[model samples]
Target: MTDDTLEDFYDAIQDLGHPVLTAEELARALDCSQEEADRRLSELAGVGLVGRRDVERDPVVWYPKEWDQQARRERVVTFPNRREFVVSHPEQFTRARLSTFAHLIDTNGSGDALYRIREEDVWGAPYDDLADLLLALRRVTGERHESLEEWITRQWKRARQFVLRTHEDGYTVLEADSESLMGNVARQVLGEDQLHAPISDTESWVREGSEGEIKRLLYDEGYPVRDARDLDTGDPLEIELSLELREYQREWVERFTKQKAGVLVGPPGSGKTVAGMGAMAAVGGETLVLVPSRELAAQWRESLLESTSLSAAEIGEYHGGKKEIRPVTIATYQTAGMERHRRLFDERRWGLIIYDEAHHIPSPVFRRSADLQSKHRLGLSATPVRESDDEVEIFTLIGPPIGTDWSALFEAGYVMEPDVEIRYVPWRNEAAESEYASAVGHERRQVAASNPAKLDEIRRLLEAHAGEKTLIFVDWIDQGEAYAEDLEIPFLSGQTRYAKRERLLSEFRHGTREVLLVSRVGDEGIDLPAATVAIVASGLGGSRRQGSQRAGRTMRPVGGAQVYMLATRGTEEEEFVRDQLRHLQRKGVNVIEADAETA
Candidate 1:
């Protein structure tokens, strides 16, 4: 049989939605004689491609050996126009191949996978050329898709059309593939703010302090700039990791070293910080780490001391509480971008700058930190999404996303996949309903989010979980305090003092405090202990990143991680909660919904 016949056989099975076929059925499918179909089946069986089985009182049947057992359990479906694929029970090979040119968006415990192809995915494909990416795509999808392939090829070319290079006079210049692109796209989009003057028809002298803006603007216009300018490596400071890196972490470090900038995106326990340290070790230069809060700044200092061959004196904390500039310093975004404190960072050259919780980098106030010049930039975030949908700026200003598939980590037992469920609780009384209904705008949402009946539901869940380590997340501080008082647990919020916050977090880590009421502050920044159960009693309105971060608090190597999202039923809160967890569902988390009374 020719290869076309073999491919037809597989296609027939998919069209039939089964694995087995008799000689008569095969003959009809192949448009050949029954005896010829039987001959082809025998030939395929001899080659171990198909298997033949005889029933007691029926004709012998033929089936592809590979699909005989997995026909119902494993399958791949594609949507070319949407550039998305869904795979059920995907094998390791399928995932590994897809990872080359696709981004894993969702998965579940049963190994159901959802992946989408984006321009960035194609631009940053880990291959030498388009042929390798196309081969991988064909292998994963079982065939080539002309439209999708054409789009990917165009994106691959766009990724290489623009380059930022260092001019001989020690200035940055933007180079385009053609004069038309430089003049029509780069110059018109960049204006005089980012471009000083045109050196050549295809080259423009870049303004001294507008590199980030230029990259961001070009990227918004569907062109990602390759930053290849000669940059300072800062003061030479020997650094080495005291611990070993996992295989994936080593790969991430290698990719960052080659690209010189990227965001390390992974689940909470996938060791992104460790990988950042690995990149620092690879770069071997002075470092600056920017975090979202003072607590995270302190945590970075501790992580560096524990994982790297660095002494306390060599590492500094430059937050509000402490101000010291050492070989390696950790500062909060607010302080680092301040006009007065900005000069402190400007005077010193940094070999590498690591942005912790980098999703904050795209905001107006925080974006100034992205302007800081460094030879290499590394960003760390569990979820790089934002409410404004400006997450593209995160990649444009920092670098492309680089990480392993979440399902792979879950399957390897490196991180536990949480069982997420959303429970809808009803109002406790008509008065409560009346108050919520009478409210207006934000007040309406606040009333719905703080429904009184949730307290009873929370108590019931606590009783069910018993002594397991748990966390209760709330959006409002008052609600958090109320929950804390009723449950007799400490409420950890932004209002909590630094000393008390540290003590509470330390107690939780050591199991002294089994349960704590956490506010928005715990959504990111401070490292909360891994718990067996996580409950979101109230959450910020429909933020996907917040939902993921809250669920990630329970994701660790240990099993039995459960996450419960509570929303006020018969109100807008239901929609908000659903929208919040939509991202997790796309990532393959099975989100079950139920009424509070039944749950």
Candidate 2:
């Protein structure tokens, strides 16, 4: 074969996403005979462009001669029984395809990725047509996985079996695709309080206050109900975004508008808050913004006033310190879920309800607010995973997962992917190791996490990255206080007075403050846009969400970002850092480990 033909053959195999392929597989992909493929491979190998190897199943496997050094093949291994897939060096297209029906679980900095395909992932798939979803699955895996496809088809059907629609008589009704589905699925799962009455064999009257419950129940039963009810879009308030949205942000808004509800899942500094505001402007109705803390509530108000045409009088904070319900109201999850405060929210008709830092929605206290009815629901989170693995509840309550993949945003310059490093520090002294060894249960983990040696490493990192805005995160309040004192920076925790907390965060945002030692309060809610470096001194016990969120503090569009996680050497802290960062690694973020002395 000519050199051009050989190059063409190489390109074709590369497009298949596998660096090595047997003659049979190569023939199928290239539409040539196996003998022809073998002959070509032999010739290519002779030219020092290809290598041939014998494996167990395949007598001969052909790959690029430089595959070991130059090829970053997208290697995908599927496990149907466990519903898991391990993909290494997944290309952009492969990742995009897998994302339609699979949940990314873990990854290493070496490009090995783990994904799980749950019933909810298929049910909440973005594809409107099953054929499209099936095509994507086939494209990603390079073959028809009959068992997986059958399961996905069933889930796709189940997700579409029931629809909550508005009846001409003005009441909400649950409509099923078939009478059998209505009886076997909706009627069987829903109580009389939820399904008020049977209007027809396939339609039933739904109670006013039971819409969220009905959806949740049906979802728990492996059937996702499509919500099409004419929900209340509260008093019309005209709003427009004063700032321009990036292309992906615009796509997110368009998707949310079509679905009327979804959680925006992207990395920090990808402008999910801006996208949430876009959804608000598209809704053109009163919006209720729910946050995990009073700090975020205040930030949301400020962002609205600055990014949108909303005035200070129009946006009100309805948390503990404030109780003003204006056109756009922001409330903390704790206060909004309270019985006394819930009535106020229930009384008003909100056109849009934005859940800021929505990963907390699965917790009992925060879950209650998710039941609030609104015409549009928009959830914003950089890391949506929770320790309980209650991600299903989050999607069911909010909507589907919507947004660009983290890797895509990082590559597109929409968000900066931080260089994450875990520095293993030795114990402060023999006494510290002794104390940790003597402790048991949770105390042991705490002792390891709060190792005093981390303070020296933190100081060194701060000095190396001097003049850059930084955030020091600690899970323990006492450790955070001590670190603050050592570093001579303010320590902001949950116990910090509201006024002081607000002032400190404001200073951090405006660059008046260079560094802040913060406790768990800085994990999710507060936005420190100017932070260029994040030093995580201690983290919650192996909480992947916490790890991702702390690192996210420095993820912005402009400038380089760095995350340094200090782990006590030869302790559980080492394992915790690995477990926590695996999530980011799977999203294509690089993570490296080093000794504190060198770091």
Candidate 3:
């Protein structure tokens, strides 16, 4: 009757070949209630002594650890038949690979990799000829890109749902590549024979917004991959400011806990970057924050320094001429995506990586940054929706996207609502209209969008919204210059020096200049929240993504924020705006028609 003898009871049950016992059976034997037996048995299992097995007839079968260990040895040592014998005990496969596998046959323990395959029939063939044999046997299984050794390793891992760490057993294990696992999937979806193309044409289809398509391909192929990631108690992220997350941001953060990597799709000024900072702190590991431009890289460093406990020494910028790596580093996608930069940072283990403006991630260069090892990743984007199907690669390379619509954020009082206006502009040269109508392709669209008449329209709006900051999005550098010179405002293009670009944007953000004209360079990464009024006088090859990105530039929650698009009445420029307006409408941006009376 002494309670001190429970360890003896546990040890006695753990004897090999002992019958499986229930709490009720054990309670009857020990003269105790089933609940008391259950509690004590749980303690034994917690200490790695007692274990459970669900037999065909029994819902829950409790057995000693010895029984579980013996059953596992049976799986590793035995096979379904002589056919699958080549899969595990491949000693007969003279050319077959030895993967510390021979060492696994005798035992199964904490560090051992478990394989559970239930095939009715397996191919018994030589290692070199196994593919053909398997093709004949399974009819569904093919050596699309994997060898017999790898296929068995991967398939067994899928059925077992356990990953094993590598050791110095002196057994060489060949690692698999993306082209092998994903190549077949890509070919099936795109109908393209060459899944891995030349560098010049590598990204023919795997462009942005392809996440959904990639998911379909994975499901169709029955790849059995369930996002090879899991989250745990991350390192405690310490910051200077105490915080309370909004309901939606909390939802995203909680989801991140479920999926170690995911995208947070809140609008600009909805604290997406702040949410990123929160994630960095939550994981409490060395963090890498990737952004699209050097300006964003600098802004991230500044924000962290101001809000987090990270000092200037702790937060480093790896962009442009400055390349510093620290506990918290912010690098431009272009800088970190390069092979040289990758070589420098790839070896370091990052606990968390935050991608700001994550829509840019599917690009060939940006995807390279994903090669670095990181346990947790948070991709932040207003819209992962892109004009190209290439974005299908984002899900595989990063993780699945979790999007909280900008419209929802707007409704929740998290981001500013847009005041959209559709305006019409006459041709800068009326005679050019005849040629533009006759012209085809990108040339005609450019001429129609770059109307010099739009400069006067910008002037009138500047006069109306006198004190409000204005951003004029021209189609090209020369047009931006002509308008900036005529209106006595600043102008920016890709040609602007990095230092000068920074200075010009600083002046605009701080009100040193109320109005500045910039070409497409302003669309992607530059944040001009002070500019409540944006005039879109040019376009980016009818790309709806470019249009939405341009609208996002003025999304910094400034009062009276308005976005106005001016298109030539009858040209393709009008069609482009109409197309972009439809895309924005789907994103819940309000579009209104404007005329002289309204102006």
TM-score of each: 0.87, 0.83, 0.63
Q: In every candidate, how many clashes are there?
A: 6, 0, 10
The best-first sequence of candidates by TM-score reads 1, 2, 3
Better of 1 and 2 by TM-score: 1
Per-residue alpha-carbon lDDT of candidate 3 for residues 476-581, written as tens digits (9 for 90 to 100) = 7877887877888778999899889999999998988888888888887777767788889887355777777777666764465889989877776666787886
Summarize candidate 1's per-residue lDDT along 1-599 as a digit string, tens digits: 45766787787778888767788887888789999988887888888888889987657987878765665576899999999999988887887778767888777666677889998888777677888788888888888899999999999999999999999999999999999999899888988898889999999999988999998888889998988889999998888899999888998898889878889988888889889999999999999999989988888888999999999999999989999999899999999999999999988999999999999999988999999999899999988888898998998888888887777777788888899989989889999999998999999999988998999999999999989999999889889888888889999989998899999999988888888889888888877756889999887485899999999998887777899999999999889988888887776667899888833
> For this target, which candidate reaches the highest lDDT against the unseen true structure?
1
Query: Each candidate's lDDT (Cα)?
Result: 0.87, 0.85, 0.62
Looking at candidate 3, the ten consecutive residues that score lowest on lDDT are: 95-104
TM-score (C-alpha, index-matched) for candidate 2: 0.83
Where does model 1 exceed 4 Å of error?
A: 1-68, 72-82, 105-110, 138-147
In model 3, pairs of residues that clash are: 206-390, 207-389, 207-390, 207-391, 208-390, 208-391, 210-391, 210-392, 235-283, 237-281
> Which candidate number has the best TM-score?
1
What stretches of model 3 exceed 4 Å from their correct place? 1-224, 227-244, 595-599
